[model samples]
Target: MPFQGRVVDIAVDEVDLGAAGVVRREYTNHPGSVIVVALDDDGNVLLLRQYRHPVGAFLWELPAGLLDIDGEDPHIAAARELAEEADVRAARWDVLVDLLPSPGGSNEATRVFLARDLTPVPEPERHTREAEEADMVAVPVPLEEAAALALAGHLHNGPTVSGILAAVIGRANSWRTLRPVTSPWEYRRN
Candidate 1:
């Protein structure tokens, strides 16, 4: 490991290709993450405006967090993030899409979940906020409007954009295209 941080690490590797020869590659070693798209019966999706220091801006994003705990299920992690970040709990969850945000530079595998039948998390049960999370505010936007914001470039977060689009497609398909919440994660396995 070239560098290691609390949540991520940097690594350099050598790869051998029979015809192309050997090459050296440097990438971020990630533990994967989960994003939640919480949709209510009123067609509104729960969102968060949180400060992303790396980007130096408060961006509209879905409730998301790293899969940091060893042996923890991604579905459970998603549920935890939703309540922690959005102060809500989802009664139903389905895998919306899997993403390789920056496959060329990092092995960050992200799973976006479509959450429905939502309910507010009791005040005492909500997660304590810290750092940037302390300033986050949960906002609900209509599904179509959120998509427009994404296309208009007002919302630039990758996973949020992808999750919104995927949710739209899933809704159009009557959610039949959504994978089960317990679906095996393929990217992390390798």
Candidate 2:
């Protein structure tokens, strides 16, 4: 009754938590990660189409990945993933949101970043060690288009959709705050 759940078993990449109460617990312990909602100069959001085995489907999502084993910084991981997954790098980055995908079961925390001032990286690193190759494809869609897709249930991936909306709203608010005020002499006739 003292919260006595110890890791009874450990695998190469996961740990099994022995029963503490009425349930057996297992977790895939992963280093915290970052997701990048990269924006190109044309005001297009970058997305990737990748196959997710658990879902048995290919879905469109923002570029994301786990942190390096050596405990790399999340912001650096975001830039690294952007290059690795989409072959693009950004000159600017803003932290839009932080999320826990499943806090009750896992320790994975994902930081969502908004990347801008895009540039092409000379070479992108692919995860060759993964069981299945991640076929990375870059799709540039307008913010409005992404919002429409989300409303239509097409963009159902939680983090991806949330990142997109956060970026869109952040940009809108920034634009609204920075826009020049109209002069009384320049008022338009309705």
Which candidate achieves the best TM-score against the true structure? 1
Candidate 1: misplaced stretches above 4 Å? none
What are the Cα lDDT values of the candidates?
0.93, 0.71
The TM-score of candidate 1 is 0.97
In the range 80-109, model 1's lDDT, one tens digit per residue, is 999999999999989999999999999999
Model 2: per-residue Cα lDDT over 57-133, one tens digit each: 88889998876546566677788888878888899877776677666656566778888899887653443324443
Any idea what lDDT model 1 has? 0.93
For candidate 2, the lDDT comes to 0.71
RMSD of 2: 12.3
On a 0 to 100 scale, what is the lDDT of residue 125 in model 2?
Answer: 44
* Count of backbone collisions within predicted model 1: 0
Q: What is the TM-score of each candidate against the true structure?
A: 0.97, 0.73
